[model samples]
Target: MTPTHETPTTPPPSGPVASAEDVELLAALGYEQRFDRKVSLWGNFALGFVYLSPLVGVLSLFAVGLSTAGGPSVFWIVLIGLGQLLVALVFGEIVSQFPLAGGLYQWARRLWNGRYAWFTAWTYICCITIGITSTALFSSDFVASLFGGTAQHPGVASTPLQRLLIAVAVTAVCLVCNSFGTRVLALISKIGLAAELIGIVLVGLYLLLFQRRNPVSIFFHGSSASHPGSYFAAFVAASLVGLFLYYGFEACGEIAEEVPNPARSIPKAMQLTVVVGGLAALLAFAGYALAAPDLEAVLTGSDTNPIPAILQSSVGTVGTKLILLVALTSFIAGVMSQQAAASRIVFSFARDEMFPGARIFSRVTSRYRVPRNALLAVNVAPLLIFVFVYFSPDSLVRIAAFQVLAGYAAFQMVVLAALRMRLKGWRPAGAWSLGRYGFAVNVAALVYGVLAMILLAAPTGDPNASFADRWIALIGFLVVSAVGLVYLLTAKPDRKSTAPEGDALEIAQRLRDRAASAASAERSEA
Candidate 1:
């Protein structure tokens, strides 16, 4: 009476056939295993690690954090990390029960309803579709720094053409890696993981040990930027640094079909990703902070991009350039992992035949055992975003800000659904679960998610900023949500979905109905 909508389908058409247990489990949930289970626990961890990419996060956001929050800005990492750890725990429980590919969409659908799931995916797609382009553009400068094709303007921005070409190239390379096979995706993740560890551990240690230019107390008191009247205000303004870094861990479960025993392994992988990623980011941030020759310059508006300066002054030019290469590698790996996550969401949505052109995007190439068309689909979408952002570089910065806001919005939808299910008496039945602590953890994650969203959406910190500039994140959220609403109403895609909604709640109701009917029959016989 669990509403086991058993999908009596042919054998898995792509990838190696799943083990009987895996196959049966997926079938019970209304899907057949279609991806090779090539990822081990470690490989899954690597995917999340590379996607989180401590080096990329710290290098990119350190200056903003430093300038706004001064030395005390470093603690945003700790605060946001702890908050995000709670989120990971909640996700751990959810993914344990529903380790389906497409991660957010799959989890949301089962916990809530099909309509809710469709919107979650729509908002999420908008986020990652632009996220890839922005991330690629961010790493373009590092790419140019090494390759020497970009003309320097001595503190001005790089040419739009330079950034566009390099970003496209980055997208192209990752597309190849992702389209080939699951094994190749895991390998790139592992390689990126190694390089990131060295960037964080080796470089961080050397910077902290050999290039220590400031006292440890710098982080406690902050700098001139946070001096006197500006202490609390400045710290609050720099919250994006931490908010941006703690995400990307969710990418771990997006390829649940490619992972073995994903229910157990993915939850562990997700939690490990948050814990290790947090520590690595803190290490890298502290190293750069203490090693900076002039902390005040970094904390003030003078040193806009302090990472390269700190590296150059602390290490020689050659070492700094080498680290840049490492950063570029991390960015590429991040793109690869992110693209995999995004494409799988499209595949999951399409397989239900609830999306436009579902047949095409859902196609899996037998040779690679991957959604080749979906992979191409995600890439092509980003190119359109690239074209849109090219004319107005300022919009590109706002796009970066909005990406995190959109992702957190989608994340909260899942959290809200899970909390609702728990209230309705559903318990997680997976290889991993929180047992008695599930409710408490779920509530806490919801609180954190809500507060985080408020922080992200509120237009504060910069008094000189215009309403549009300050409210960009909120504006972006509304625009994306509006578009999704229009689509949901117009297309009515949820009507076509075959996956069970309200998950166990629906199953429990069916059981109750069957019990009542049997009791009536017995009484009539008597």
Candidate 2:
């Protein structure tokens, strides 16, 4: 007689809530399904766009860029846009292979080792958390301006305290939304993306067609600066405007686990996000620059926000406010996406037992299929830093931007590491890849990333600028990494514990056992 019974089956690891193909992919990577796979390709694309948030980055920083190097400085926007496309290509290859949550962190861990992954996650977490607070603060100022808050009317203008209150309020709403899980976040991001696209098209066309000041000259000329390298300095300073715009496209990669066929969708979504967002940003920035009635006057004037000033002149106050109201959704969407990506990263690190409270932060809620504790960790840490916004408000944006650039530089290093692995005969195992061209693309990404980092490191050419301001990126980089080192040395989490072996044969055995058990059950019932 054939065997009366078979060994107990593991039931195919239930609750994956994904197609068998997706489940197998995760299992091959040595992870069980922990998140609900609800986000679609467009949803992934939307999150990436929202993270870029052209309205927020372009509008808030346009005035600063103009002041730094006149109207022509918008050239940096286009240049950096091209450079970042190279970076995104390399990122696409990495995510295609890993397609894990914590995006950069997970990629580093898999590509190199646990130590590299720890520091990568640490830097990213710091950069994004600070970004959330600063972006919130930036949005609160715009919101305040919507209601007669201007330096022209000191008494009516929103005070620092009020701005802080609003910033905190915005952050709280983002936290609550994130707690609802990926489905809610995806819906909100899609709607926000629609609003952003509409605003970009309408506002850009209006400024370009009706309000062209000197469209042709705006691209070629660099205005007078006080120093010898002032033109170069101005260009460097303005590069931040574009640098800020290009990042956050990686946000899609951070939530890869929440998508089906992530290897295919995530990489495509990232590239498309960069391409679409880059065009939209270039148009928006160029439109504002071309539309400026008197670029020099606006740059030198006492108006704290020259973009709005230009907008007010071109379109009436009501029209400007209407545009701003739509832009506010971008800000809100940014916060939602930022929190989601950051929390996913935290969940990835914690699941690997890297942190002290690893087990806590790693726990996934069954209802939402989200990392509840990780969400709390990501938001609460940033709330503390938001308090600093009250005291040194001017430094917040600069510091946040610098931190992000530093993180990106380090992030590029991971791409270089992948290239090193490729040289050692590593082959692509993912659904998407650069084929034989991967090495060239990877090298280009490194070249672009290194040059961008050097440009970013250059000072603003202000002799009077504070030491902290001059080296803010380096300072932030050291502090974040130092803290990470301390924790890493002290805690010394076991690498093997968090580093799950990717044993395809082991997973296959489990599947076979489950299939055998199912067959035996049918025979008994028959």
Candidate 3:
């Protein structure tokens, strides 16, 4: 017979070589996956609302009260808002270009080296896991408040065991909701966000139009016991606290992989969320500043229940009830959003073989196409941490706060890495580029992020705090990271295969041929 086309009998490449090709194929497949762009956009925006609640803005006002206990000054609080805006812009720039599911971790990897990327992702996972726990604790506190019980009650707040039980219950409910699917989460978020906005608007309007208070002068100019030092220091401290209100825009970046046209959509969604959110926060702060009763009383009240005190003082029983109800909705929305983002982050890490039990964690459920295993991991890990809260209630709040702050710090560091890339002429093409202003915006964000971390770490005028209480948060973070470090060091890289590479090249060629053929057909018809 004429020379027959002999099929290659050689074996395919194995191990690392085979693995690399699989990864490339997976990436290409991801490019073909589609999501409803509008639903994705609104889902993201609603998620943003769930992320930033009017109640948190109210909490920021309490921070203002704490900072200015010696006097009244809204200037500093407003400046804090400005600082957050700058940071938001920097985040917008980076996430716009690289809207992947791994978020800051992926950004760190692409901008810096692979080794550092593992640590960044690890820190992010810990921060978010702890954050979910903290949100659950806060949700428990809010639920308990609805029943006229303070978080510090002997049965609830006084004993770590009691608090942990409450935390477990709340965590269970949130985990269930998250496991249901994104559509359910999105629906809950929309309802929760609407209730929160209405409550804030009603409360603010009542404060502004119905209640009569001291002239604006008191808010702009006054002094009290907590403000014994320089006004600047007080304002700076308050700004740090206020910045917490602007903390969750990065939630958008975490879900980027699920969004259609993510590179364009993520940046726009983020920018809109922050700008709109900042304005809303500003309005709420104005309402509080204008209607504040006794600044000292507001600051010194049980930190857990400051809003109740303010509402009771300003608008009587009815207003306080309304505020409580709205605050509950806000917390619920927050829990839902936290679970969604945290689960996605965990899933992304697992998909990359960065997490233990990756095969299970990375598997998407055939029923819902959701990462059920990852969701379970996200939910269970925190419940275990909540168990510790049962034994150490005093440390729970601080631990949660520290974990969230650490995550933010890690995110900021990655943004700084991207900024360095820009300096090195590694310009990425994208619809959401910062253009000429990227450098300045990133610098401001980095400075603000670093300063906030320092202030948060420093003692809050409290001495004699036990080591277990103060350092437990950092210890938890370090432990999680240590585990990730060991995994990254020992895990073998997956190999690539030439067959898959050849297959990809052939597929690409077929696509090009089809396009060319279509163009020729159209010309003939014309």
Candidate 4:
């Protein structure tokens, strides 16, 4: 099948492209370095940081965490941060080797086969598509509050229809910001990083130092430890708080072609996102929990969303609005970054002719040196889902609940594939590597993934809850997986494309051959 506009088969004649090593490595991994390599190590870290968007994660889930595990909830960030870092370490090795676009999908295909990759990519596309939709929709509350539509519901829309309209505008703005190029994406990341630092770190510090009503002791033992189900159950019930905070790290590698030294830069960025972002989130949670005027109300779930109240009390009305502004930008950043990552996956699929409209979506426009069609395509589905968003006003939290679990399922698919290859004596051969520690890290990452999935998918044990609320993650995952299966069987897209599929050793061999060929050409030119 022909691409509607040809995807660049070689770097352009009269412009900057990826570094010589980056170009060779990308060639080895079965893609042209079409995107201009503009993302520095800091920019890469910024993308992961903003995409992880600590303020958005902590603020969105803080009340729920407080309600569930009380003071002990803060520790989950540390616990899950450590677990996700293990996953990132394993990812660091794989991405350092392949450094391909589409992150998890590209790694899975190269480590295993195109069929496995097909399902993996399909699952990932669905997960991220749903994931960003929820994010964009969730931002509506902030948007509504800024406009002074309803005082009774401070940070939420007065009606579902109002929310749908607000959310549509947010998604539209994000898409417009995304279309400019990688530089814009990097700039947005930096902006988001600044906003987050202020929103989480600065706000948390002030709250902890000056406005604390309760002592620091509550972080160790909040009042809810003595519930009927016990502290362990409460801890497990509130697991989503930690799961949500550490996610944006893997996004560092999604645009591998856009960074100069992806193999090294991306791993560092992923690790930093988990570590720095984790600490920031912990501080924010602690500050808010300690500063709450009615701590018992938050713990008992009477104050369902206590963040605005906490901010207003401690920082006053103007300060609260300023923080809300920061939170709004963080939300926008999360949606934009997620959309950018998903578009790369879309482009990768289309480049392989694995997507339905490969002819169109595969094209990287010559002007911006980015995948223009694929980026636009990312928002099209989410636009349609606004109808559903209008009906389910709390759709953001609901879908977020499911995607975190589904996200783990997608992440573990690559980890499992890598582990299988490792068992067969294949080792990572990226510019950055885990060395002798690679296999150990891979094993540990898989263990963490499995544990996280179990914890995330476990029932919340609220009998009054609807069946969908209790089992949403499991049900949503099964439905998405089933749909992908039907398409894989019917469409059989993987068989039609000749994209490379092999174990890591085979991939490494391709890298060596490509590097040698590129070097030979340079020597001849010299």
Q: Point to the candidate with the largest TM-score.
A: 4
Considering lDDT, where higher is better, how would the candidates rank from best to worst?
A: 4, 1, 2, 3
Q: Rank the candidates by TM-score, best first.
A: 4, 1, 2, 3
Question: Model 2: per-residue lDDT, tens digit, 341-393?
Answer: 88999888877777768778877876777787888888786677667767766
Taking all chains together, the TM-score of candidate 3 against the true structure is 0.79
Please give, for residues 1-526, the per-residue lDDT of candidate 3 as tens digits: 1121112223223211113322332254232121112236767777776776646545434544544442344444455566666776776666655565667766675576555666777777777777677766766654555565432331122245555776777677777887766667777777776776676666767776766354655565545334455655554445444545666777877776566666577777776667666666655656665666554455443343355555677766665666667776777777777777877777766665566786687666543445678878877778887877777666665675567567766867786786777666654444466778878888887887777666555544323567655465455556666786676667732221011111222333443555588789999999
Q: Candidate 4, overall lDDT?
A: 0.83
Which of candidates 1 and 2 reaches a greater lDDT?
Answer: 1
- Clashing residue pairs found in predicted model 2: none
Clashes of each: 0, 0, 20, 2
Off by over 4 Å in 4: 1-13, 149-158, 222-227, 509-526
Worst 10 residues of 2 by lDDT: 1-10
Q: List, residue by residue over 30-116, the lDDT tens digit for candidate 1.
A: 677678888889999999998888889997788888877777777888898898888888888888777788999988888988999
